[model samples]
Target: MKNFKSEIENPIISKDILDLENKIALYYEGKIDEARFRSLRLARGIYGQRQFGVQMIRIKLPYGKVSSEQLHRIAEVSDTYSRGRLHITTRQDIQIHHVSLEKTPELWAELEQDEITLREACGNTVRNVTASETAGIDIKEPFDVSPYAQAVFEFFLRNPICQEMGRKFKISFSGTDEDTALSFINDLGFIAKLNKGEKGFKILIGGGLGSQPRPANVMCEFISVDKIIPLIEAVLRVFDRYGERTKRSRARLKFLVQQIGLVAFVKLVKEEHKALSNQTYKIDTAKFDKEIILPEIKIPSVKIKNMETYNLWKETNVIPQKQQGLFAIGIKIHLGNFYTDKARLLAHLIKKYAANELRLSLRQNILIRHVKEELLPFFYVELKKLGFAETGYNSLVDITACPGTDTCNLGIASSTGITKELEKVLTNEYPHYKNNKDITIKISGCMNACGQHAMAHIGFQGMAIKSGNLVAPALQVLLGGGIIGNGKGRFSDKVIKIPSKRGPEALRYLLNDFETKKEDKETFLKYYDRKQEHYFYKLLKPLADTSNLQQKDFMDWGSNEQYINTVGIGECAGVVIDLVATLLFESEEKIEQAKASLQLNQFSDSAYYAYTSMVNTAKALLLTKEEKTNTQAIIITEFEKLFSDKIKLETPFSEFVYQIKKNKPSKEFTTKYVQDAAFFYKKVTTYRTKTRSNGNNQQA
Candidate 1:
């Protein structure tokens, strides 16, 4: 493969691409451990798909903003390196699957030319920073959150504090109290606010969705915008130090905050304040507040063949921007899957007639902003040709679904197949509900909730049900979950489990009941809450009966073969390995990174890198004794217990490690911390060598 390292303009990004190339070579040559390589690749946005060899590349777009040129670049890269398909994720990322792992470096280089990145899009690092797709143009917003979201994305892209954490961290920004960005379900969520003429944010912390969904607790009702980034840095530092590690199921920031009560978590976060690089980082919104330049094109006259259909589309798919005389056109992408051929055409259309930009919505749709009202018909005509003019934008027919069994390794059933069936049912049987934005439907292939099923008005989680000796794919129906605005949200309760093939019928029953019994202005969630879980369970109980199962029930949706309940090891967060050599090797890498950051005069980053190095070295040694090295806190304490006598330090081991939070990350302190880390690493390495020399070591 040709190396594109020299073509990358940013030296840091160039080094990143070169490092990936080197790592790939090392992995192929069996120099790096498989688990270690998996972690490395995943952090770079190279994910292993359900298909064995090909990888999925997640392109991280901050706040979902994409320029026409960037879109063209992405489409070109897709055509060149992938199968010419793009899948927009719920986190506002673009994913291209069936890519060769070896070609990823080059593909990433191509993307970098357009100022797009794949860094930290996955793995045990900060994922994509998402926000409201209508951020800059929301009428109800106190201010646009695009600049804040972009600032956060830039600050943490390759920051040492969050890299190699126990699990992935997620952050989001909402432009208004409407909470369209779903702030209640992220690690750190910010809602734009204005208090007494000062710009601020309402903060939510430690929210997540999986088998067990937890709503975020209010960290504060309001905090100045300048303090938000610092607060988030402190939170990440706390999570990295104290969050669970060994058990993948309980490694999220939510689990950490839940384990130690929210009060204690907040205290720990406050303790990290001094260690942060900036006490107050102000986000500049001047660039984002600039006047949007719309294309100056003569309005094309297009006669509407179906005036009623165009009107329905206008009602459902068009959003009036806060800016006068301009609009935002919503394209309801089916299953979030669109091809590069159409992508190119859309790119051209937006560049020629619109604002040369679009936002990939959180619900896996496209929002073309800054369109003139006169251009609506032209957009409709163009989008319809590409099958992007589906009605029900953010409505009942606009279903949110994960890639499920199609490409995801963790998927237990076909979420897309069932989504298609339900859409058919909704469009054909209940067309009146097309514009019903009150109800939300989401599907996840498994309990991991990548589809965010737990937070939907109507949710389905894929599972397996047994009938005698045979197993069939099933959907666990959940109800009564939705955003309640202003950082408050609800989680759905599992009502019943039905065969996967009957998913459409399950939707039909729920929607029918909701349609008939709901009060005049009652939302789906309100109706669900009134009816309650038991009532829905009773209503859908007939589909749960397995005694009268047909052969088709044995098969999963969109599959010809009978269901076998096959599930591979999930890399939603990369696998955690305890290989001692790999750990030591990683420790050395961290030390090198610390030194590099120190040279660059990044004091806090250097200190954190050194801290990670020390912890990693201690964990490596502790693993030799077969000790439980779960969290960094545990690693620190256990190291003192087991190796305090063996390797004497100037101060107690805990005190030495705990200096990170005790003092500010000054240049002098960072230099000393790096030295201390190096000394500790040397002592541990010498101790291990002596133990091995005397034949006292149990393992290498």
Candidate 2:
């Protein structure tokens, strides 16, 4: 009911926010369908929470690099529109929850004041492009991958082909062979490399984690940096044309790679060369190559009250930067959460003492960059005052957990509650393992693996144990999973299922066993491999007894009420497309977008918009006859088979549509293609109208 003025310098972003406001109004007025509205809002990063009426807003932060001003702005917006809490995600994005849908536009507008965005942060588009938090300062990196990651993020933010895909796509860049960004579990993962003294990346394709986890195939041992963008574009084109649409589960790129061999997928990508916007889109790393700016003020003298604690913190949380006399400090945020009161202080501290930049890590922690060596004590003191100077950042004690039953729609059990309980267990009981980086502990509320539970050394997935019509909260303990660097990793194996309350004891059993039997200098994975999954299952099997469950066993952590698994509709997944009028309307909108792109002389973008328009129109016509239209390539082939003989056309429908793949996206070709698409839409609509006039008769 309230109107907010947008001060965003980018007119496109301003229009997007206003459009969201208009759409929200239309949906409330019963003009827009709920499904259509859901898709629109998701693209803008406004997601439906497990609790009805309140929405979750995911702020898109490319590679998790946030400026101090951006951090301040996010804190302000969170305090104003929603709760003061900020939740950092494993994807290297920040999410704020409990915001009103009607007020999202104003909230987004406020964030735009500091050059932040919400576009493509959710939905089936290119989600946040994550990278190693230690990208620029990592001593082992060949070159900084931040610039390349940022380039890809900007190139595909509003790309038409990915705007409405069958499923969400994820990409990541690991700065070095350590693979700290966890490249093995992304749709497209890039590992920074030096090939013959040239900037390049080791490319991995089609890897993903969900209900089914798949390892990415090695697409290339080395691809030049300049050509990576074009390669990604080509892969996206192939996916848009051939990826599954009808089945949500089988629609990810990983499933496509599984259905068709990686070799075939590579061949399809190569076939899209003619349609690609650029053969080599060179990135200007000069912009990202700037030196860290430090304040000229003198470092104030600070006294440490406890030398032992400070030493422990230094050994665990502090990291030496590649740059001389500089350090990077890791802030272990409990469950990746912090309030606005502390956020503002952090923003001020970094702006004045550090490099004016902070990177949110893939493990749901914050890494403060470019702090002078002498400022460690001062930074530590200041951070401790904010309740953020916790030791064991990114260690075994630094547990990663997703907002499961707390806010996520697909949460089956409680992740955050278990995470808190486990943290307490580690702190009070196993303090000696504070610096144990060999073991990773991750938890997810569901099998979707948002917490990256499947990739941890010790993983827990929320489940329910049944005993004759009664269900109790439970956890599936997993073992022997971790990143092995250089594009190699292992997905954890499910070891045993136990009651939720016994999770702490299960962890204690595993640790005690490892402590006693692990060989000297052997990692957790090696020790676990020696013992095997069955060994751990047998060890923890005693805790899996459900027949003797008590009343407290049915209660999940951090809740007073009894546990009940109520999973809502997940927005992270793809949406189903079925409405005919919506399809036709989208086609018209695509045509208009094509015209706008053409006017701007962006021939390649315009051509893709036109191609989508033609495909959408075909889908609309096919829906009228109740024919199957799943993928764009299929629609093109089926349209020719079903309508080339029935409708009079100057050229065959296949030839007309497939021209996109046969010709370069030059101005002349783009213009002709757009005109042809408009003509095809007109003819299809005319036939549909005539058929509808004849008592809704079905015609091919």
Candidate 3:
């Protein structure tokens, strides 16, 4: 992977952190006290979501490795401050959520005890560095990538210029060709390979997992270990100056990479990369290489006569260890989760059993390596001590999910909860489906696309819908998404929009339909794509109140078709993950009040107190349940007053009429910007607004 010698020697910290600590310390000390400091501080650096408030703390897990004590401590953090969960991100770092504002100092203090920190976790900064979670264990790997990921992470952790980059930065390393590391999904990816018999990395540039998803581009062949950091630095330099910052959605490196063309992007990176070091790269290659060595592994004396199940699991899980008779074991954890206590116990067991070797996977799972075949049973016994090592390593729950509403603020749907629900319901109803392979289901709470839904074979996006009078929401089903091969991948196709309550049933129906009608060895997407146009419209025909599903029949209620069928106020409009993020992050007290009184996030309780004078302040309008006799003008009158302070409707409607008549007309909202940022946020949060952005502020 991309190893540089000095990377781990001295880890970096952001200058912004120093400033934040001082400011927060002042806030905590009762000096310079302002009521808004808490919210401002939370929004500026701390992002809140479903569980505990999350800080997006990115712990540097070199080659996705962590110590036994560190694992326990992470669990402690989760249990103490978060929703008692730890997420192994696709980039091979750990993302903890639901961290409290009051706990920042303590959290930072505790993390430092284990050599971890939350500095530079978010903002326009370089994020946690990643590598092939299977780095050294996979036999095909030329060398251990742990040290390289560490080196890069260390070398640039808080590099002064990285404090305020033009946009977010991502980097990844893969130790083998099997590419379980997912190098292609980062802004810069390095895959271990040989150039003219010299071991190094083939560089891929400009890939990401956001709204505008793009598989990376190959830039050059086998950049030497010493040169990796320089190349990264060069790329960062170009991105820092050239990446678009005018729009937050268009601010990622992928946009610049695409805009400039991959060849040109590579050329720019190379020029800046070689400039600072005069093309030699200042890293001490020998020192970095010396730290990594082949470790001796023990062979188990016990031999297994029966190896069928083991062999099958091995086909999917185990990998080559450079040392003969030694194999890397991949222990799948459904949704990449294990208890902290369990993790600690496993840590102790693996440290003793596998000679201090550990690896994590992109799918939020854990991998243990360097074990002998004979010791499999012993490892299994130990794993059982931690609630793992059950049959079916790649079982249905071995599903992968992003930290959607579970921790992220931008999520639309509750991916974790929905994932859990899907697992529970699917297992109870269709247990046999667990054995099915290549059936990937990805859920994104929002269209910020953090969940990588755009690349899943079966993807679901959370969205809001206006059913007659209810503020009901639904998920937009997608098919045919995945990494095609190498770094090339396909985006999912938008198929049908189904109600949120019907998600599990919808999934079951889709899978059943696919299995029944599919030809021999036919994939889900193949069946889906063949009958694409006809399938969705036909199924959803009954679900629409006045769908006008006909391509030519458009909604004329709003100024444009885009704003039609919308409710009064909600976020995650025409989206899913965003709604999940909004609903999941609140405290129990806050949530109960919201549901009981129909309130918004920050203003829920206060809004109820102020607006309770008028009864039925919050009403759900489900269009599908209504009659066609509902006239447009009558419906508009009732809807217009729903957002007002009085119980009587005509007064509000009259005011709205007067206000609209007073304003001069310009372009429609679909083609123009409106100073309704707050109103816009509500539409998305409430799932009521029909107007939508084409996702990410970045428009091609």
TM-score of the candidate numbered 3?
Answer: 0.67
* Deviation of model 3 at 393, angstroms: 4.2
**Could you give the C-alpha RMSD of every candidate to the true structure, in order shown?**
1.5, 1.7, 18.2
The candidate, 2 or 3, that scores higher on TM-score is 2
What TM-score number comes out for model 1? Answer: 0.98
- Give the TM-score of each candidate: 0.98, 0.98, 0.67
Collision count for each candidate, in order: 0, 0, 57
* CA deviation > 4 Å runs, candidate 1: 696-700
For model 1, give the 10-residue run with minimal summed lDDT: 691-700
lDDT score, candidate 1: 0.92
The CA root-mean-square deviation of candidate 1, after full C-alpha superposition on the true structure, stands at 1.5
**Angstrom error at residue 547, model 2:** 0.9
lDDT of 2: 0.90
Instruction: List model 1 lDDT by residue over 404-486, tens digit each.
Output: 99999999999999999999999899989899998889999999998999998899999999999999999999988899999
- Which runs of model 3 end up more than 4 angstroms from their true locations? 1-20, 27-46, 50-58, 76-84, 263-267, 270-278, 282-320, 391-397, 425-436, 523-700
Q: Residue 26's C-alpha lDDT in candidate 2?
A: 98
Q: CA lDDT, every prediction?
A: 0.92, 0.90, 0.56
lDDT of 3 by residue, 1-700 (tens): 1121123233223333344556677776876344334333432335444444345444546557776667777777777776666667655567666566656655555565667666555556676677766676566677777677777877766453354454667777777775555667788888777777766788877787766677887887667777787677667756754665445566678888788798787676655532232244444445434532333556445444447644555566666677677777667676665666676677777666675657676666677776776676666555655666544444444556665544555655556656776777767887666556566777776666655677777777766655554434456777777655444556777777765556676667777777788889887667767878468556543443333233212322111223223322111111111122222222222324333333222221222221111111121221212311122223334545444442233355334222222332222321111222223234323443221243333453
Give the clash count for model 3.
Answer: 57
